[model samples]
Target: MYVAVKGGEKAIDAAHAWLAEERRGPEDVAELSVDQIKGQLKLAVNRVMAEGSLYDPDLAALAIKQARGDLIEAIFLIRAYRTTLPRFGGSEPVDTEAMACDRRVSATFKDAPGGQVLGPTFDYTHRLLDFKLAADGEVPSAPERAEAPETKPHIMSFLDREDLIQPEPEGAETPPDLTREPLELPAARPLRLQSLTRGDEGFILGMAYSTQRGYARNHAFVAELRIGACAVEMGIPELGFAIELGEVELTECETVNQFQGSKTEPPQFTRGYGLVFGMCERKAISMALVDRALRWKELGEDNVGAPAQDEEFVLYHADNIQATGFLEHIKLPHYVDFQSELELIRKLRREAMGQVRQEAAE
Candidate 1:
């Protein structure tokens, strides 16, 4: 039956037209350029890129524009586009040691190699509104200075020499790609990290916060947090050598954690690692904390029934796309189900009234 309920096509078309007008705002106002969003609102672009698992700044900017500056929507656009791309070949892992770092800091040591460079951070900035920016929006260029040489050794190398930290086994085993396969519980570290890097920033932040609130608390110290660009390389089987593809901005974090030794082993400091697509230090740090918390079983610690410690729970709910799809589905038509429920409720009420009247007559 052709019912009036199916007449939403015209309404949807009109709604889309209205949305387009609202997105552009008034014609009198200056139209926002994608370059402006990419350059000025760089952090938002970085977040979309990081979560989308793509590295193209231009495309990310375009996605942002199309999404009306909604970060999640932009991420969704990028991710959806990414699925249509043909997989050529995987690149060799980039070396962070050779990274040209812009921002590098460590909390574990007072003085470290490469001398803690604090480049372009809002850590100490006052949160007060800048009236001048609102009025003119003009920003002066920073004073020119000679670029320092990049020679920072990892903080963990010092502890490694002293045999104070747990040593990871060196191997060339290829890790599982979460994107290609169905997620199964008791996930490996690589799968867990994959989920976390592409996870919703707010969700990962909350999970990390839970650890700080004593949910499987692992005393974590930021051993090193670095933001910079590293050259990506890909091996050519024909040439029998690896060639540089390009450089990509990355935020890498290494967290030193307290590990209580089991009956078979000695106590030593553990480690948690986080590496993201772009300059997202907050997400990187949060991923590290959550990563360490989920390492309970491998580290020989009790489960403690913490949310972050549950691999199944963390991996399943970490994806924003999946979460949003399920959540938004509630708005879809449920007329048949609601009607059935209404009829059942009325019938129950009538039956209760009849029972009461019979008891009164008795």
Candidate 2:
């Protein structure tokens, strides 16, 4: 006997309660503070901020805790909170050239204007887990260096001196916001770069890897990568000037890609760029490569129909929040739709059986 079950509301309430309990495990034990999460789980917080398009570490940490350690859920939470926030005004384009960088390096050059500083990185470290960190051990700090100039230089400027790199055009026009509007086909460079900045780390990495594996193999050299904090300024109409709103950490990567000299154009190198929130160098670098690959059409390069070269494919699927939402949404109730499909299949089977019997009698 088939019986209809109806407890959707109660089930939802119970699930929510369980989730809350899981998020704040063992009530007797001390709860995790936002500061502790921000400091201890820094990489996860960085990923959330980068994907969420917000710079607040504390908020990101809180979201992480609330989401029960799901990074994408944390990003979704931050994104939802971001929408309710009242935007006072737009900020002036940050001057990366004037950025006081903590770490800056270039793969294209051995030495540049701002000397290479390989700050804290996991590149050289062995993959083995550190046992000392299990007890929350303290390590000795490195010796401090002399204070550098307030306005540090960019490595790309050195290449521009000899006209080696293409000069970026200066524009005073404001760019469009992707979050406010539905993404359209044939997006501009600004929009594409914006989407890539907050894109899923693994998705971007896979796309970048595809290009390297001959999907659209454009030889790429890391022109420069910089990680540091920069002041954000907002224009105040009352004051008639921009004021420093706050400071945020950023990771920026610029890649010099191979360019085949066309009949009309000279053999000059092109570029791919990535800029993301916080100190996420690997993600930024991967994003830059994919960005360049997607720009093949504008650069007059032949499109090999690579996944990386497809603008619609890359931009639409890059966002982790959107991807995860759609993926997980399949778990939601679809009983009505499933029932309709089942009825149709049963009707088709009955018709087939009747036809077979009639044919056998004939």
Candidate 3:
């Protein structure tokens, strides 16, 4: 049975009122709208959606506003709101191969089949701050572009024809849901991928960086990175076919690692994969590296006892919501435990003082 901490009604009400007042900020300034957040603060909305495991941009933006721009707290609000949502039938795997390319590039190929198309990126921009934005935030119109090719073939397919990269046969008709299932050790690739895609970005990025810093022997080559809109199809049993639900923006990364051949297999390059909602290239790349690091056993490699290689550790600590609850609980009322500790410490001190006085008197 859960114990409700009863009391402090007035104080709680006062705190809430003050919090609302603070959230509103100065009366002179205009309030931010959800549409503005969804349109301008696209990355922030993407991060909340990715971590919250909800793809709705408008809801994510509303959560951000409600949380006063605290992303983790925004994610918490989104998660709480998610519980009320009804489950629609799951969609078939989205066809990334036929994605309408917004930004597609490959490090493995200098002049690949579909040449690099640099769409809105910060990669080449000088880091200097534009002080003009302090007063006015106006920008000129972007250059128009002709529509890209109807189909941009995956770069990895070229290597696959030559048998250079390891093959990944599709298994598991339906992937398991981490939200529904209790996380068990020795998780399969599908489950691991599920957790990684929704996992905390900072944690995943740090873990991936650790591998790059010699914590693990997993170094990745960017075989291909693509960002685009793909149609989502949901199976309609009544209609006897799947129908397109809508389009969702996705970022996918495929990385090739060093070749390692076991006794049964010949020397071939291994691969890592990352796919997430929106143009989250950094998180996608991080997830791919970490994914590769965790696949040591399956790839017939010995474990070096790295944190990233430990599925149990990574999976348990990856969810920021779970981590925050565990951590934040300590700050709540722990009066009973704190009082017990205080009494014990005082008793020990009294005994020591008494012994010292007795010894001196004798």
Candidate 4:
């Protein structure tokens, strides 16, 4: 007996209301303020901004709270919101060389022109859980240094003196926007870097780890990792002058890789590069490795069929929002399709049985 299904709309509405209530928790409890979330959950905000292609901390925090800490969902929310925002003029590329750096370090060099500033990193911290943080504990402040100059010099300049690393070329051409346009193959450096920055962090990390595990390993050393804010300027076409739009925190990674010099070409170390929004060093580093791996073809290296080398695979599955959405959508009702398949199987079984009986009788 078949029963007609009803109340789907009402049921959905009720479920939504309950979900909202659960997200908020008890009415007596204090609601999560955007500032609190932004400050306390900075890492989550950073991930959302990186993936969502938006840098608003408050908006990312709100999305996180609304999504109940489902980071991918929060990223999706931010992406949807970001799409509706009207496009302003594109900014002149922020000169990383001129960045007001808060943190700068080089693994390749013991000491460089611009002294290494460790800044804020979890690198030195012990992994043991801090029981003090269980309570609302405040961290002791370290002695503060006097405010220094606004701009800090890059360490790469030392290597640049020897002509070891590739010099960044100045170009008048504008880079393609991956969001507005479809991602085409054979992308430029800027386009490829853009996609990698907003890619799934875990996937990028895994691919990077795979390289260390002997998949197209190039023996990479961190040339430099810098985190700082850079001014974004936009040119007013009518005025013919660029104005400061804003500033954004960026993590830039440059890796020195083993150079493969041909008989004709002179031996020199090559570089892998990554640049990403916010303070995402790990993502940036991983991106740089993958970027270098993908360039094997262009660099005249043999195709090793590495995961990182496969542009189609990396670019296609990098976005967690797209991947998770399509994957989780399978949970949605597919009863009609399932019923059709079931009916086909049953019909085939009956036909086969009939043919077998006829053959036996004969």
lDDT of 3 by residue, 73-188 (tens): 99998888888999887899999998987899999998887789778888889989989899898999999867645567999999999999999968888788888889888899
- Residue 292 accuracy (lDDT) in model 1: 94
Whichever of 2 and 3 has more lDDT, that candidate is 3
How many clashes does each candidate structure show, in the order listed?
Answer: 0, 0, 0, 0
Clashing pairs in 3: none
lDDT of 1 by residue, 1-362 (tens): 22246668988999999999999999999998999988888889999999898888888998999899988889999999999999868888789988898899999987997878888899988988888987897789977678656598888889999999988756445678888999887788888999999999999999999999999999899999999999999988889999998999999999999887976558999998889988999999999999999988878888899999998888899889888889988898877777888999999999999999999999
TM-score of each: 0.95, 0.94, 0.95, 0.92
C-alpha lDDT (0 to 100) for residue 26 of candidate 4: 92
lDDT of the candidates, in the order given: 0.89, 0.86, 0.90, 0.85
Q: Indicate whether candidate 1 or candidate 2 has the larger TM-score.
A: 1
lDDT of 4 by residue, 5-69 (tens): 56589889999999999999999989999899899988889889999989888899999999999
Residue 120, candidate 2: C-alpha displacement in angstroms: 1.3
As for candidate 2, its clashing pairs are none
Reference-based TM-score, model 3: 0.95
The residue-by-residue lDDT of candidate 2 on 120-222, one tens digit each, is 7777899899999887779998878886564446666776787766566554468878988888989988889889999999999999999988999988899
Model 3 accuracy (lDDT, Cα) = 0.90
